[model samples]
Target: MRRTTNRSAHRAGRAGRVRRTATASGAALALALTAAACGDGDTTGPASEGEFSGQTVTVAGVWTGTEQENFQKVLDAFSEKTGAKTDFLSTGDNVSTVIGSKIQGGDAPEVVMVPQVGVLNQFADNGWLTPLSSDVEQDASQNFANVWKDYGTVDGEYYGLYFKAAHKSLVWYSPDAFAQAGVEAPDSYAAMMETAGTISDSGLPAFSVAGQDGWTLTDWFENVYLSQAGPEKYDELAEHNLPWTDRSVVDALTTLGELFAEDDLLADGAAGALRTDFPTSVQKVFGPEPQAGMVYEGDFVGALVTNDFGRTLGEDADFFPFPAVDGGEAPVVSGGDAAVVLKDGKNQEAAMALMKFLASPEAAAVWAEAGGYLSPNKELDLSSYGDDLTRQTAESLVEAGDTVRFDMSDQAPAAFGGTAGKGEWKILQDFLRDPSDPEATAAELEKAAAAAFKG
Candidate 1:
């Protein structure tokens, strides 16, 4: 359910400007790993002086727009207090390329904003990240979820700390539209389908989806499968212990396929949606005289809509909890960004200090206000947030105990996630085109998943 409110939600727009200023203002871009030594290979605490003194620490991240701006504010505050110069490297595009070059050249930044937890493992495996035992111990609750922490740990040492969480299993819709249609939010999967059928019977698309990026569809499948099979099976699939052809997995795909088969159920045709971008599809659902009645996406989709389309979050759309699957445990699939300390930097202490500071409630609040992200820091009092939607999102996270971590396609072994991620979307598209043969589509996807996960 896309959650829309009548109240206007505010967000920062200074990300690009702040990044440009930070990068241009006297801070040097550290040489790549090849040009610099791995900093004595010492696992000791940060240095107190010399090369670290008056030295600028380069921080690389993929966050852009308001998220980047929010982080920049925090970094600016850190610089003001600590006198440690900082350089901002905004690698919005080609992040892997840039990070790979830095690690290979031995000039990786002191801290990096990692988009996926799996990347931390890959970095640790490649000796590109330092174990952040001190940081984790100092800020215990702010560390990664048990699953992510365990996954990110290399040789039993933690290397990354998550800073925020996004609730995915959320279905956003227009309350006014719902009222107009005289339909209440569905509480069960069967009811949800019935509601969709009713909405479609009115000649409106029941769900708004853009499958062009493929990841959007993947998100839907992940949420449904996670809800249907429960977290245990979800984890098994993530670890490749469960076959993609498992009955539960096929059932989930079939369920989604049935939704697709309903005429005019989705904003665009299955093939057209497969080619539409996320924002575009979302607009079709939230635009004036919305073409679709609902959209299933993460909490952050609100941000994308408000930031890009000048749409007010609360006034334009609202979200509801995804209905419970039949005889399945209710669990939310949550995704968020994390911070990591890169190896081979001179200002390690300063960077760690900055990281610890950023992990604090104060910093989290700053981020929440600036970027509209839900702070992962338990110590943060989210009540301070002025925006109702942001506060609601924060409350939802707290209310949801033990959320399942988001499965990034980049997190699994090289070929597994990326290939399977793409394959899942294709399967969805194929199933949509011919609902009579969901089993066949599921079988093809199972074969693809098997080959992708093959050792």
Candidate 2:
């Protein structure tokens, strides 16, 4: 729905984005946590008395509730550094349409925090995005991996920078629950299934499956596909260079069905799971009387467990990397929101300044210390994270930078990937409901994908 005219319908029930880590080896990088400034008046040191004395910058994004509050902390840092008045406008879930209408009315914000790469592509295609300045580009190159930069590029021109990252390849489980089952985290998918089976035999269902939220299904498929088929096929499928009906698609779906088809492995059987949304699924696993021992999703689940359930990560609950499919490196599927400037903005200088600041580790550390956040910036020290589990999780993401892939469905056309009750979301929901035939499921996915890509 990137270019949709029906803003209201699109806004009603859009799926929440579940959205990170470090370098190649499992070890943390040795880069200095902070770079020294050349002189006392160095602009990099911090905001001078009034760097941009009389400017204002407005940023729009789909973040609401706590996410919005955390993002505001980042903006507040930017304002304090540059002496600019910063404002945030929550676009709800329909950012594309809301921003599009604002642009049409000649009132677009100075910057937009795009939640999907698909929508960023849409905005870039519409000629609404301003090509970022060389300084901002250099700042991004220094802070982020080439993969993050690639997501913001359109036709060889960089237009944005990923400000926040989400690692979607985590499996959160109760430490006590794992001990009760007498099992540890497994490295490969086969071993994971065995672990789940052992846990289930110990009187608790193994996994909390959030079937009611179609996006969760897409994340599950993406991690398995990326692990089994590898990154090359992932890129091809994401771009539609490889059709959805390809053997790889069937293989991935079949692998996922190994979990979906097992009623006993799920917290609530298949029917109850189909009625369970994301938050409820988390509750079933982490609440006082848990029904399930584990749940699989992004690192954001850490925040929910801590804030909502008052559980401390690494003690009451913790997460492991989504297991490998065929015994190689387990794949890391990441998601993020990028800050892109508007070409028609009233204060281009201020917006670009904000963009440059957002690309710096200093800005990222502001939110990182606040909890429930991860950064793709290679230089940000893992210590900036508030907890040990978060530090280790962020380290894993950084370690996998060379092989990491963004959320697959997010890289597709919004009509196919982001929308609810249609295209990939609905089709995956159907597959979850009845995963008997992987081949048939792949065919249906291909049909929807082809039509969406064609449009």
Candidate 3:
């Protein structure tokens, strides 16, 4: 819930990330058909020893613990099949800083899992990354969505391949609470407002909005703006190409006020939301005598519910698409970690081999089974997932197609997007505390964006 807590809960999600392109003359698209002709699927079973034999490549990433253990299975398979050794280094929270320091120290790992598209682009621009090899480019293009492909590409060269993604436009609700309140989930923004009204009238709070976590509030702003203002406008705003005070933004914020404006609709009202963490936000909704009817956040919310809170998905807690505003379709705000190869790595072939391995369905399946992982690979076998609902969640993302957009805040500058207790985070918190004045809030947003973007 970065949007969530610091442990397993906080490793919430990522968007498009990728690697260098195969050719300055070729598009990532041109190789897709060729990759399909070669029958692209999870083929990482084993490999014969050759030029890369006995080579040891290192990978640095933010995941650890069971997540690390699960990923080790993939690494071990790579080692077994290719006769190449690979070691993983956890990059901690400051991956950009750590990678930058390593680059300066001339000791960069062969490959690094970059979490933010914005930061990845920064690396590519700085010429700190090696462009993708032809084989890696074709594999990514064939398997990943064009949006993801684009995220990895800069100046016509691919550098990051998006391996995983998280869908943020979801509202998790308690079926029991909805039944008790006698209100079904809403299919449209208007309907959701009405549903909340119904729940409030039935003597229950409607939403456990996590105002304590500014990222959650930012996601709240992102989804509403994306659906209401449309992707083009959303993109313009995300890149600071448009001002926050624009009518589309004002309209989205005004629309958000419909729910936030009502004190009774939120769990313990604005005061409670300000005090509630992400885990507690969900806990309050599904716990004994849930004070609220629902919670809105990324897919990790479901993971926490099933893993941490010990709740069943379909029976206890289920989510619906964050309904659209103004007759638009729901927007898919994708998130995840992206892996890239370093330009100065010692074992180039082994590093490329690891990226190629990760792009496969077999690699994705390994993490899927280990739980708390979701992939955007169309070739992945849904049956390999542990549960039906988890599979369904993955399927829902794949089905989103062109409607998918990376998390807007994630794509913005860190000061504007990533920093907590600053920029959009603080402004949005101010918003939940006072939705009646979106005009004032939008002005504050514009001021922050100008300073952050200009700085």
Candidate 4:
């Protein structure tokens, strides 16, 4: 439940004929995304970023603090090596509003890191984004899989390139706690329950579930549904093409219920879970002689453990992909920020230069070494990562390979996917509070989704 938003907005006008012409096409593009192992895609890297000496590039993103600081190193490298002036701006939480207002006022950054593909596509549809340049297209083809390249595609043209990627279906845990309690990561849902019971018996709550952030509850259900019910149903539920009350949806909820059933199973019980924010949920397990042994979240948890908790990764904390569901293969649920070029920018050459660098492995390695980022570029040297733990985490994402999907809720409409106090967020919070009536929960979820989707 790290901060998330749909931020859907109407982009007013289209620059006449902003679409780039396609020469040769790759495989037919489908919105479903999955990647193979390392060097999985048609891995290619450009010779070098273009020289944009004596010019400036304006880049905007939602990152701040460490993320922003680390990215500055990349931009600084580009500027120093190529003599291009670069400025980076963090557009707080209301990125859509900020960018939209800028667009209306005839002032927008040359490049923007869009967090949601669905929202980016809306911007693309309005012609505010320039389609990928030919060289950029070639770079994307060389460095990324078709899935990564296509995530940025709108109407057969690519508009965004994924610069930062995250593997969301992961459970962060304390290796020390697990070993001390003789608890092991489970392989299946049943094994998870048995393991939870064992860990709880050791006097620590087995799971530090975060109920305060309802999106975590959504992830809890999504990972199960994607693995157990498969992608088609997962997509349908996300788009609301399938009703929330569907048996498949209930099955996902019911499977998740196993973890929520007993008060002792949760850290500080349901009441605390309902109040504990995400970072605190992590602290509960990795904090001093903790109350819990595990907390499920995304890959960013490693950075949180090391940077926020003043702990080491491999020794103090580690993570395992969400276990298999009902003996089915585990699905890799991912979320990432993609960079797009604004069609209306004044510095197109400098902007393209930066995009070229981002699509390459060398620059990605810099961010990788800086520790708060993950890149979709398979060309990245695993050894460049600051620690083996992070390298392993990245490897796992690629290893799960073909069994990948963007977070379902993240791809849905804003009101349905990202809004608080309604839709999936609000409804899933209720589910965590009371798993006894999933059918009712499903009904309420559908009600919210139907209304929001209409909006």
Winner by lDDT: 2
Q: Which residue window of length 10 is worst by lDDT in model 2? A: 26-35
In candidate 2 the C-alpha lDDT for residue 274 amounts to 87
How high is each candidate's TM-score? 0.82, 0.89, 0.88, 0.86
Q: List candidate 1 stretches off by more than 4 Å.
A: 1-53, 142-148, 408-410, 419-422
lDDT of 4 at 306: 79
* Residue range 366-438, candidate 3, lDDT tens digits: 6787887788886677776788777778877876654577887777778888887898898888889889989
For model 4, the stretches where C-alpha displacement exceeds 4 angstroms are 1-50
Q: Could you give the candidate ranking by TM-score, starting with the highest? A: 2, 3, 4, 1
Q: Write the per-residue lDDT of candidate 1 for residues 322-383, one digit (tens) a residue.
A: 77787665546777666778868667776776666655565666666675677655556666
Indicate the residue-level lDDT of 409 in model 2.
90
Better of 3 and 4 by TM-score: 3
- The lDDT for every candidate, in the order shown, is 0.63, 0.80, 0.75, 0.72
lDDT, candidate 2, equals: 0.80
Candidate 3 stretches greater than 4 Å from native? 1-51
> After TM-score superposition, what is the CA distance of residue 382 in candidate 1 from its true location, in Å?
1.4
